[model samples]
Target chain A: MQPLRLGLARGWVTWRSVNTTREGLANTIIWNALPLVFLLIFRNATIPGTDISVGVSLLPGMLAMLVVFSVMGTAYYLAAEREDGTLLRAKAVPRGTAAYVVGLLTVAVLDVAAAVAIVLVPGLFIVPGVPLGDAGMWLGLVGYILLGLMACVPLGVLIGSVVRSPRVIGGLGFFGITGLAAISGLFYPIAVLWDWVQWVVQILPLYWLGLGMRSVFLPAEAAALESGGTWNTPLTIGILAAWAVIGFVLGPVLLRRMARRESGAAVAERRRQALQRV
Target chain B: MATTPAGPAIRVGDLRMNYGRHEVLRGVDLEIRRGEVVALLGPNGAGKTTTIEILEGFRTRSAGEVEVLGEDPEHGDERWRAELGVVLQSWRDHATWRVRELLAHLGAYYAPYATASHPRPHPVDDLIATVGLTASANTRVGALSGGQRRRLDVAIGIVGRPSLLFLDEPTAGFDPHARREFHELVHRLVDDDATTVLLTTHDLAEAEILADRILILAGGRIVADGTADALARQVAGRAEVRWRIGEEKFVRPTDDATAFVRDLLTGPDGAGVVDLEVRRTSLEDTYLEMIRRHEHGDAAAAALEPAVAS
Candidate 1:
């Protein structure tokens, strides 16, 4: 309980610090706005055999991308903080690690929320035919975002713990997420890809997260164009929850193993290596 | 929490650590009493960091019996951890955090562990002043000078008001003025809380000035352990005797400086003796000789030199 409270405070402090900084603000704006630019470019285009604008169809996918972006963000922070000795600092205090995890998760969630808002608020005014009047749509949107974070944050921690270098995580993680997005049908229908690729993407959380977001934002008529010719709400919920469970189960084990190996000498050796690289 | 445990603050017996085939600590043994300031002096790559890490439960030893505050560090819990303070060599962690902000956040973790006799967490403002960072209390850690940053590290270490503190090369990169201030801060801390400290350093003068007892680690073992004066005397009980007779100057190394000086003063040239001086072997010389003999594969000879002279 105490660790949780402290972690929340730590998370708030860190989030505020990052958001208030010019670099942090610039990063948030640029990344979130990139998807918005795509939406605007296709604003006048309509879906094949439908009256809905392409921009409206792409908004849910953009929201899903924001959630997916959090996965890489979480991994980047974990690896960077570990390299910088912040993780070891947490280990020094009583229950500090617990607080650190809570704080990290808090920041990750807040980042997703901020990114989602940046795209969604302006998106609401620009993209037509979003069922904003329906309360259930709003609830479902919030639910999917929360579920997406739960599924992704733990996977990020697992990746961060396994990878020793932040540069590697940042570089590889960006390409990896971009590739996943390509296959997960964030910008187009999965039916257009090969059957095996569709099968592979279905096993991952991003695909389900994007499916859940589409269900909430797209009109019922859009379901006709989805894979299997309908929205599989149960499958989307089940797959995302399963991914969340797998991540929660495996994340801590790897994180603890990585943490157990941390010491002052290790940190020093890493610093020496980092300096040599520079 | 009120009733402090009774016994040595730290006890290690036959502590051995090996990295594959390379043995770092072959067989190390030492004990530190409560409230005693002990310095672990060793050369680079002498397993100083390894030994400290094992004691701090950050590393596992291959073989040893180790107890820190009456519990094996290998299995020490959070309660055990709260009783210990570790001052790490900082490398840009928490840089965005303000001095006061970081201290208060870290200190809050100890709140539940506080006791009537030994309060957990020294006050934030007071701790800032203690480390001479009061003016920079609100300043970002990244903005601090090297010396100021080191002071903040110390402040963070003791913020939890730990009963036992581990300082690993606490003043490594400090300039002279910063070093002096750091030493004074340590003195005040010890005077105020009687906190048992175990610090590792290559600085012999620092060990002499700051430590109640000094342990010289060479060749993976404690080659010498005693007060600075005792260790110096153990190394051959030798001293340099210098004097001037008219235009001639004389210098001689002898095991018995007092007797040699007395005899010289009362001898034939006693009336002419001027600028008389006797200088005992400095800790630096003793440390170098110990390291040299050990490096030459004369461990027995080096280990015996101190006892034989004593």
Candidate 2:
């Protein structure tokens, strides 16, 4: 029952996230709001029937990209807590890992909620009826974004389990997200890419999320597939399910090993070496 | 007659912790019996924390045997964790919650509030008062003075009222007054709950006052484990009787101070014995001597120093 350990860790992480966002607001405001402007403003002089002219073709991919970028932030929080002594404290508390995962998931869900309000709804508003055509279509839009982010849980846990330093994880953050974004067709459709590029993107999980998300928003006339390049929503979801299960199974095992690390000795040695340098 | 309990409450026999080729705890063997507050005294990197963590079940040993509450800590469960309260020196360093909130929250993790023996959360006010942090109860941990934060750490450790408490450098940041108060609190807890305490401290004075027995560790092994008086007898055990005689202050270590004083005052060369002070070897001296002797590889030879010097 001792939920306090979990509560405390989750609360601290949430507070840190809010602080980080507030500190970086000047940059985030520009980066976050610009896509909305492009979607609505560029529609003034464009063709109605064609996908590229009205920004509809770009809508699904952009939203998929938004989900990916935002979920990456939560993963960063997990890695940060692991590096800091706070995670070590949690390891000693009762009902430890089970309680901790519950708390982390709570934050993940809330973070994804913020992503929906910030990215999905606003982007849906700009693209007219295509992204939010009816009740069913809007529901699908929400569901896929949630599903895609949920699918990313395993990769996030794997990263959090293996990484020990915040600086290295932070340094990798941009490349990790953007590299996946490039291959996933966040800015451009994978269908328009060269043969080798498409092959590379197809195998990555991001490509499936992008494709599944696009299926909900764009009309059937949007992209012509190369015979077997057919979009399967169930297959997209299945891969995510596999990833989530793998994470659920391996996260604890990896964390158990990491938790056994001699935290005090490590901290003491680092502090010792640091003093020696001084 | 009260028969003293025999077996040690905690027994670490040839315990070893290894990280590849680096051995942190090199076969540490120690025992703390019932009704004893044994202070584990050592310098940094002497495996004090590793030993404590292994006993608390936070770390597993690479070799040897350990038993806390008669169960191996590495395999100890929630039930065993509930039996022992650990006041880690750095448990709450990164916390931002209020002092009171942190203590109360951690207390919930262990209070088997409905036990057939003693039920209910260990009184929070009692713990807060014991650690002398009543005034800083509501203060955010971030805003707390270092001493106050340490008091809260102590409060959190005993929130569940465990039968045995493991306090690692509990009063490191406390002021002199607060440290005394904390020592009294340990005594009070022991009296009230019969809590067997095992504290580790660098402050020898603290060990003298709070510990019924002191266990000195060096190179990951206990070199001395005995009552203050027994340990004091390790080096220069006899009292040094000093007195002013005419223009000279004379000093001599004597086993029988009364007889020596009788002889001094009754002899024909009788002189005035003013400012007379009888001083026994202190706990600090014994502890230091033990460590010195252990490091010097002359345990048998060095053990002869106190008696001969006397």
Which model scores highest in lDDT?
1
**DockQ winner among the candidates?**
1
The 10-residue segment of model 1 chain B with minimum total lDDT is B301-310
Listed per model in order, the count of residue pairs whose N, CA or C atoms clash below 3 Å is 0, 1
lDDT (tens digit, per residue) of candidate 2 on A1-278? 45655465655554444435544444455555656776887554444556344566566666676666544555665665654445655555555555565566666655555545665567656666463436777787778877776766555656676775555666686687678777666556566768887877766667777777767766665544322455677777887667667766786687667666636445445445545766
lDDT of 1 at B128: 92
Give candidate 1's whole-model lDDT. 0.88
Output per-candidate TM-scores for chain A, rounded to 2 decimals.
0.97, 0.79
- List ranges where model 1 is wrong by over 4 Å: B1-4, B240-253, B257-279, B307-310
lDDT of 1 by residue, B46-117 (tens): 889999999999998999899999989889999999988998765578877788889999999999998797
Shares of reference contacts reproduced by the candidates, in order, are: 0.63, 0.12
Query: Which 10 residues in a row give candidate 1 chain A its minimum summed lDDT?
Result: A12-21
Model 2, which residues run further than 4 Å from truth? A1-63, A69-75, A121-127, A130-133, A191-200, A225-230, A262-278, B1-8, B19-26, B92-101, B111-113, B123-139, B238-280, B297-310
Indicate the TM-score of model 2. Answer: 0.80
